[model samples]
Target chain A: MRAFVRALPWIGPALVLIALVVLFPIGVMIGNSTRDISQSGVDRGGVGLANYAEVFAFPYFWPIVGRTLVWVVVVVVLTVVISLALAQLLDKAFPGRRLVRMAVVVPWAASVVMTTLVVHYGLEPYFGIINAFLVDTGIISRPEGFGWTRNPGTAFAWAIVVAVFVSLPFTTYTILAGLQTVPGETLEAARIDGAGPLRAYFGVVLPQLRSALAVAVLINVINVFNSLPILRVMTGSIPGYDADTVMTMIFKYMQNQHRIDLASALSVVAFGLVVAIVGVYLRVVRPLEEA
Target chain B: MRHTRRASGIIAITLATTTGLTACGFGGGTDEGDGGEGTTLDLLVPSYSDATQANWEGVIAGFEEANPEITVNLEVESWDNLESVIATKIQGGQAPDIYNGGPFAGFAADELLYPVEDVTSDATYADFQESFLSNAEVDGVAYGLPFIASARALFVNDALLAQAGAEVPTTWDGLLESAKKVSALGGGIAGYGMPLGSEEAQAEAAVWLWGGGGSFGDADAITIDTPENLAGAEFIQKMVTEGATQADAGSTDRSPLMDIFIQGQIGMQVGLPPTVGQIEENNPELEYSIHPIPTQDGSPFTLGVADHLMAFENDGDKQEAITAFFDYFYTSDVYVPWVQAEGFLPTTKSGAEVLGDEESLAPFLAVLPDAQFYPSTNPSWSTADSAFKALFGQLATGKTAADVLTEIQSQVDAG
Candidate 1:
């Protein structure tokens, strides 16, 4: 109390500024979500829950939500699982392990958009290196590259691949941080108790990794849910909303479509949806961390 | 003590965020007359290609030389994402002094742009191609000077057409038939190229809609579901079915058509005159001709596209600098070379006539008088463009045209 009271003068000004900076935009977004966005994009007047109702009624609304959930689930789970395997391998003493660790972190250092562009070229039908390799090995019949982002299925597949690829390094590093804290004696005890490496890892190190895995998976969920640039650059929303997640769809609505009210309403709901899910996720996973 | 520490941590984070955000606020404040030098006009332009950006920078240099006191800060953004970029800037109250874009009706309605009459002279109006000038205006007031005007034309690969023994189709039915024949040659040749990628897909589809006597609706209302529009939509679907366009056109970008056209694999595509530069760069000897997009009854109309130079009011010398820069930039010495470099038809009547007989410019220039813009000057048009692309993409990807049109009409009418 003394510390807080003594700091009031400096903190008051900062607190006020922080409120203005952070809360102000959120307040405006909430306000606009309920306003009728006129044809000219001005707020005509209040429309109650009209905008929310409209977003809910959008034909692709639920489908986009379903896809977003699927995308978030897959990206988060795969990132954790892949990173866990890599982190386990990276944790052990190996020749040139420092070089391998540096290589593992390289993707995290590179720009997401630049890497996405490289991924785009790799999947392009006409001149994709991936297509050339596949054809050269007689993996597929056609000489012309297979149209990767042309359909929703392939686009979604490639989007997940790129998402997992970019997500790998950060997740691996996080889990690696957790790995360092695990006492070597605990793992040795498990091994001495007549457990193999897989059994010891599964029952001991994996459970102990709860906090780091939770942090990684939670962040990835939020990131993949809101990620727009990768799918936007890769797919160009070719099939429009069909290839976009809810966040990207919201971007299309606000930016390209200029449907401000609809975008705002969608944003508010999306924010709430994510918050609620995270809350539930944390509640369910809290026990493991506590253990 | 733990609770106090947690509260302190929260305050620390909030304070840091506040400081960071407040710092970002510094550079965007209104300049109260940078009373040091003359003035600096922030000119934002949509760069069509690398050459276009170079031409813009060159024009800015000439303007700076002519008006030594005033400095023009030239910023170029790609056309693909410029609209959204500008929208965000405007909403954030950080709009530039001058912007190059389409006649956005929303901007006009919101009065985001100053009326072009602020800088345009009678001679300026007389010199500019009337069609380009008129379309850039809303409610009797124009926003910007049209610096780049591109009228879409049916660019035919003469070699491929000759090899396939097909004449240039001047009518809608004939186009389908000829495209089918050329596609039959089939060494990865597409008879027609349909772009279903990005916001530009909606623009390209408008050409076909125009040829079928359909409108995206008048200034007052949206009638995108007109029978004529359905006819146009059906025709596009038919081309896909007949193997005249790519199987995965809905997923393909404009690069494929441009690439194949350069390689003599694409027979026909509705393209701008600037494709001459692309062709020359790729394969200079590839024979091609630019003609008007064919109509149902062999009538003539082409989609007239443009990039307008608009000003946003920032008060005082900034406004003055924008007007002054426009006047200097449009002069023949600066304008002509910019036009020659960009390869688009010169937006001005004087510039057009001066280059009227250039062998490459003649065909596109000949059709300047009859070009039509999409009824999309309205700000909501872009939003409608998304719906158009989605529904149109579905149609191209094998959805029913009538069903797609119904959805488009629903989205627009509701808008």
Candidate 2:
């Protein structure tokens, strides 16, 4: 009883914050999803799993779910790999390393919307520099420019590209910081044991960077999954086209279609997916720590 | 370490609570100030353009001169996300005194809008055109005051037509023939361009179906799968299959299609009266003429829609002010200048007279009599719109029109 009373003051604030911030919104979202929300207001009816049923019944929903998964996986893997490579390249004592490091962080500093618009307009068929070069270099027989947004494959690829581009700077910087903390003596010991640069990197450097890599990967996954503006601005939330992201779909349903209940339901589903992904990640990484 | 942990826990709880409360308070505030019985009237219209906003201000000045006691607070919202913004405001109990919006009556009938009966009277209703008045009526209750009207029309580039030696198509057959002739020019130019992207696309596509004597939903049941609607779908499919339109039409929205039209890459395109203004701005020397959307014979009528000025039922003072402002807005001096500057057909009979005198707007006004409003009187018109869009998107992507229509009909019926 004395120990409990002693901890009450600190525990009260933590409980209040959790209840208000995380639990309360989740509760509201769950409640909203079960009702028929429209332009008028929420219709407080017992729509037991009906919104979820509709989401499942819709043919486009699964494809979007599949696409989102692919989007997250591709984006996370590409971001981590590219960022790690950049971090390694910058880690070497090279000329203009400071300038290169600054350049690396520029993409992270640029607004996602600004970068998307630049990419969108810059890839225009008639006037875009990309197409202009392709045509000028006789890369193709026709002037039919690459429809980065219109084609589904290319759209997915570009979405991944944008995700990686936005995520690269921060992840790279973090990995670089992680590399700096790794003792030089470990690499020296690997080199003395006749390990090549590649072998030493794989056995020593990567293992040392595991914690940073895990954090980077986890953050990248969440950030990419939550990203709305790039896809929303580029695709305008048209279903079955470029709008495959869960956030964009939610925005479309709630704002464009006025189907708040369905949006909320989808949001809950998204939240569950995120939680499950994190759980699986933690479970998988547990063994790595003990090793 | 224990002290640090305790402090962090407190901070986290406070942060969480604040965030939760903030999210919950998004759309729950009530409007405190009434318009106060005196004379200041608030008019909320979606922002269209800088020039139009200026014109609205000028009209308010003119209105004030005529009725010195009345003042208009012209609040303009952008079209993008305007519906949600309005919905949020209205739901939050802070609805504007007088707001103009497209498709408000249907929303009102669905219980999304507040009733405006106290502000409107039978005498005031009698002054509007029958079609205009009918567009704002739901379940025999007139919920909105019609302000401005627009209809879809075909904007034809005469130079492209001349180059192809094609005449203006008045029928679906004629349109198809002309489309082929223009596409044969072989310079990346298309015969026609219509939005096939989403709901707006569906609406534009439905013009042909409706013109061909097709009806989507009846009084008690949905009928999207009728023969006429299928024929209309097939007509669009034929255009796509025959190489008249670009294969990308299924994915392109109005803006890019408009861009294509402006770049002289499309021979004919369907656009509102504003396209004339856009053409004038983009290429002053462009040879383009406005004509009625090509029909499937039998005196084809263009699809017309209107934006309505409505009042909420919460505050009496605001309602009275809104009523006064609506009355002022329809009057000749203010409404005429607004119609002329904004390039939309006026709603009132007298207001139409003013629009007839403007050379650029005359063509749109001329087709007003031949315009057909959306026929559904159901409050769930937005749902119908979604079903229609889904159906039309499938059709545009080469799905069997009959199957898509059947699916849409079933969904609408179920809804």
Candidate 3:
């Protein structure tokens, strides 16, 4: 108690910073979610949870929620699986491995919006490189009148692919760091105990990556769930919310609908969903960590 | 003790930060004041062309030379972001002293703007065309000053029409038949450039719905699901199903489709004045003619669009400076050049008399008398306009015209 008292000044600023930056905004968002905000953003008096009710009553709400789930699950799963394989391969110390690893960071290092825009333009029907190549190779003919992102389904699929592409570097690096910590002696011991290479890896190395995998999965789940740029740039202009995720829907509610109150309500609902999903994940992972 | 000195040091740092922050707050407040030092006005306007900022800056230079006590800070934003930028600025309590954009009803409804009479010289207020001035009124009180105007007319690709053995369409049925004939030419060519996409679907909606003898309702009510409006929407769906428009008309935007039309691939489209400049710059060889947009009964229909400049009631003290700025801006010497440079129809009578003789702008001006506008005076028009932009494209997809119109009607009703 005495030491904590003495340390208060040192930590006080950090606590104040957190309160101002994080807690204050959350409080304000919750308050605004209950208020009636005009299109010009004038705040009318509180309306309880009417904004939330409006959000739930929105025609596209359920579909957007479903798509958001699919987005988070598919992107995170692909990212984790691909990163695992890439990490395993990199651990073998191949030539040009340093250069390849640096190259892996390009999509992650570049601005997500910029990268998505390049991909978006590259898929344009008129002069896009991809469409040109496809036509040249006789894969698609010009008479078909098709663009790569013409359909919402195809556009959402491409957005997921881009999401996985950008998510690879961080997940791979985390898993690679975990792989390095697994001592070589343990793998040799497992091999000497009559296990095959695959068996040795699954038995010896996989269990040691548990904590790192947890961190990667948790972070990727949150990041992919909250991602806006890939979905926005890839399929934002498509008429309906058929390809929309919750993050993009929140943006559309404010931008297209001019319903700031609705956006805030959706934001709070999204916040709660993230917390619940992360809680479940932690509960499932904590026992394994202890073991 | 060392602990006592450390605690004292921390307290001193906190005191210094609080004082510094408070000082900044006071500094910002004073800067916004119209003191003897000078009155600084923040003018936020949308970019009409690449030269938009330079033109405004030139006006400011002259205005400042004439009135040395007023300083105008200019911020130019793209038309796509202008609405949200103004909204954000208003929400942040930093609304500009003057703003140039469309849809002033929401601001006027909130009493965030000074009425036109308060912010403009009496002469300048009287200078606006009667029709245009009345269009800016909300509940019989004007809030917006007409800044620029453009009217839509049918742009026919003469070469394409001739190749397809079609003439310039004068009625709805004639339009469909002509578009079909052009589409039959094949080779990745769209018959009619129909852009019902997110960018500016409302403009296309106005052209068709109004042409079909439907209205988007008056200020008191909004009626989107009328039979005439349905006919208009069904025409778009027909265009899509018959392969008269480009692929994915649901997602295609206006600017790019306009580019295709400029490339001489489209037979006909409704276009604005700036499209003339675009064709000149990109494809001067593409022969085209401007005609009245086809109506169901062969009556003249042109979708008139105008952007307005409005003054905010910020501190209720910058009125004099804003008035001076408006008077200076609306002067013929200052206004005519800006209008000519941007290639838009002038909204004032004097400015019109000067530019009505320009060859390229004459056709649009000829159609201006029959012009109709979106119900921008209604506070709910912004909501309806957005609904049109976001949902109108669904007609090209699988959504029925009736359903889409009903959905838009419900949105407007909810508002």
Candidate 4:
């Protein structure tokens, strides 16, 4: 007790914050998941993980889990790849670079809900500008334009597009910061050795952005996994389980007259998946400490 | 510099300690609110647009004038946001004394309701529409007062009907025939507008199901696949097969369906009275007619949804304050104009009697007393509704109606 008390001045605030902010809500969630929650969201009492059993037993549960996994992977991979390209392009000296970078950042600055609404309208089949433009350009017929939101495949595709749109800037900026740290002298040395621009970027600079890329990809994975706005708004809350990710399902479970206990169980599982991914990432990254 | 840093550290520790204790208390149990000289009632109302909020303020001011000793704190939550907000508040044990909501069964089951007799006058309780009261009842105990009601009816486009040379359809066969004629117009017109999507699958399906003498699950169960309900689902499929409704009706929504109707792209659709205002606002030249949803035997039946005012019990003084305010607001002079200003139907039989000759609402008002509501009584109905919504579009696919219905049943059972 004396030794712990002596250390309190240095570590007390963090321990107190974690106890109140993190552990309390987590405790509440696990406690509620063991109980029956009324539609009004009051926990009636413990039922010993019956909520978890029920949620897992749903016919679509595993499929939804698989879909969520696929969504996070696809969205995060696409975001990182595109953002890396943009970051490399922006890092090069060019006229009108600031304007292009600002344009890239606009989607990231937009309100996610508003971006979802704009994307929804832009993708509307009959009266949308995208369809009109595509039709006028003779790229697609009117019938092709009218059903993107209705079809699961196209709807999921568009959801990824919007997700990537809003996620681009932060990833780009993160990579650009990493690129800045890649010494100009190193690029100069590569060029002195007859290395072309692409070769220098690939062989010399790209390897140095490993940590930034890893951090960016990890955050994108977690964020895309929890994203609900794109799917919710574009589908108008109708995208069936075939197209829905786990986050949207959790939202559906949390609506009026909701199954909050089950939502809690699902949430705990989602958190566990995120933690597992991070754990795997850290294990892979553990080798980087010596570098 | 070391002394200044130490002082800053001390201040930071003090702030963190204070915040930690407060947060811990909030995370656990907040002390009961007690600040007023007399009683304070916090009322959580569904968010209102400007006109409706003004009317509510006027009524609240009048009540406050009549009872100065009691204070009412009106917290208006957005309709889309109220669900999560109330759930958080209720679960946190800080539920408002009165809240605006429908589907009160969960609250009633949780034993959270303050009960109507506790917060309503004897006269108002006796005079309310019994269906409104009974629908708000759980196990023979009334827990809510019906505040607004809506009923669905068929809306027809006059230009399309005239072009197709068809009259307003009152029978299912007649409706299908009209839809076929409209589709046969062949200019990219939806024969009929169908909203078999998630946002309102139950609302969309209810008109057909109820008209066919089917019902959603009663007090104890969910009835998704009864023969009558299945027949209704089959009829919807038939409408799609015959090109009497949009081929992509499963992907459509109420707004788009209504928009196409107003634009004369669809011949007929199911709608409430406000559809008139919406259409009139969008296209003044469009002519339309309203009637009851068609039935196999040409019977008069319609689907309705309602919202209610509920009081959560905390103390006798708060309950008494709520009762006093409710009695003041229930008068014909106050409520009738409110019903008129907002286009919602009357909630009380006496309010309907007062509006007997109001021609504008006659079509909807005629069916108000007998209108059936969504089966919100099942504490699990909300969960089931989402599953049903997700499965509704499967009717347009290879899945059988029984499969879709059973999918919903299985989810509800599992949930």
Q: Tell me, by DockQ, which candidate is best.
A: 1
Please write out the lDDT profile of model 2 over residues B252-369, one tens digit for every residue. 6676678768877789998888888887788777788888888888475788878777776555655655566566677777777787677778888877765567787777777778
Summarize candidate 1's per-residue lDDT along B167-264 as a digit string, tens digits.
99999888988899898886567788777665467766787777888888756676788898888888888888877886587666676657767777
Cα error, candidate 1, residue B17 (Å): 12
Query: Order the candidates by DockQ, highest first — what do you get?
Result: 1, 4, 3, 2
User: Could you tell me which 10 consecutive residues in candidate 1 chain B have the lowest summed lDDT?
Assistant: B17-26
Candidate 2 lDDT tens digits, A1-291: 999899989798977866765877777778877877655554557788999998777667877888788888888888888888999999999889999999998988899999988877766554567666777798844454554555455655666677788889999998999999999999999999999999999999998898788667766666777677777655652324335667767776666556767877888787766656655776777413534
The true-versus-predicted C-alpha distance at residue A16 of model 4, in Å, is 3.3
**Candidate 2 chain B worst ten-residue window by lDDT:** B13-22
- Docking quality class, candidate 2: acceptable
* Global lDDT of model 1: 0.75
Compute each candidate's TM-score over C-alphas: 0.90, 0.89, 0.94, 0.90
DockQ of each: 0.41, 0.31, 0.32, 0.32
What does candidate 4's lDDT look like per residue over A1-291, in tens digits?
Answer: 999999999999988876766667667666767878776766677899788887788778998888888888888888888988999899988999989989988988889999878777777655777876776687875442566677677888888888988999999999999999998899899999999978997899888888678668766766777777788887654535777777777776776236777777777777777667655765776423324
Candidate 1: where is the Cα deviation over 4 Å? A6-24, A36-48, A287-289, B1-33, B36-40, B313-323, B376-379
lDDT of 1 by residue, A1-291 (tens): 999999999899977976776666566677878888653344478999999998998888989899888988888888888999999899999999999999998888999999988988887765688877877798967556677877887888788889999999999999999999998899999988999978998899988887788768766776777777787777674765687777777776766666777777887787777666666776676623457
Clash count for each candidate, listed in order shown = 1, 2, 0, 0
Give me candidate 4's TM-score against the actual structure: 0.90
Off by over 4 Å in 4: A1-15, A137-145, A284-287, B1-34, B48-50, B376-380
Candidate 1's docking class is: acceptable
Best model per TM-score: 3
lDDT of each: 0.75, 0.71, 0.84, 0.76
